[model samples]
Target: MLEKLQPNEIVDSIYQINLSHLKEKGIKAVIADLDNTLVPWRSTEIKDTLTAWVKDVKDAGLNLAIVSNNTSSRVHTLSEQLGVIAVSKAVKPRRRAFRNIASQFSLIPSEIAVVGDQLLTDVLGGNRTGMYTILVTPMSNHEFIGTKLIRQIERFFLKRIKNKST
Candidate 1:
């Protein structure tokens, strides 16, 4: 059970992810979390660096999508601005959304990489669907109240995972 929560890779932010490395690993598409992973939690404000990274992902011949548990309006609005596919209200840690994205992209699970800031949601969901998972540090402290609670539990797991790795 705990193994399912483990991320295949951990990075400080999405910007640190190497596109070429992903390509080399045979990843054809990327599914990203919306809040914190892309923009700050609940914020539509996009950073120039993020725009450039998105462009770079496209330039490298990779498809991108945003899957968020946030409202449809919030997710769709930001996805449109970024020109990427969006799946809103995605209850993560479930396989449905991840599987659907794979189907939409016409790619198998192994061909997609799921990137997000949360282990329980993004990482667990991706792993459950057999997709490569990358975990990034949260962009800001601001988050939903429920997420704040989940973070506390996540910290405990993170520590255990770290200790095992060492």
Candidate 2:
């Protein structure tokens, strides 16, 4: 059960992700978390670098979706700016949104990757649906109170994984 929360890849940020490599692996879509993963938890505006990253993903011929547990308005706004689909209030760790991404892209589970900063949400949810999962460090130290608590728990699990691997 705990292992399901483990991510297939860990990176410092979305920029570190190899879009071309993903395409080579036959990845057809990416389901990414908006808050913390793409931007700060409270930020509404998209950064220039992130804009280029979105363009690169699209240029690579992979579909993209921004899925978040945040409000629809927030997600929709960013998704529009990034020119990707948005799934708001996604209640991650559940398979509903994951399945939705697959359905929306007309891709199988193995052909998509879930990207986020949270293990409980992104990794666990993606793993549950048998999708590739990538965990990136949060973009900012600042986070919501609920996310802070989850981060603490995630740190513990991450440390355990690191120690075991070493």
Candidate 2, residues 29-94, lDDT tens digits: the string is 999998889999889888899999998888899999988988659789889988899889889988
**Worst 10-residue lDDT window, candidate 1:** 69-78
What's the TM-score of each model vs. the native?
0.98, 0.96
Model 2 has an lDDT value of: 0.90
Candidate 1 regions off by >4 Å?
Answer: none
Please, what are the lDDT tens digits per residue for candidate 1 over residues 75-152? 998899999998988899888888888999999999999999998999999999999999999999999999999999
What TM-score does candidate 2 reach?
0.96
Q: How much lDDT does each candidate structure score?
A: 0.93, 0.90
Question: Top lDDT: which candidate number?
Answer: 1
Candidate 1: the clashing residue pairs are none
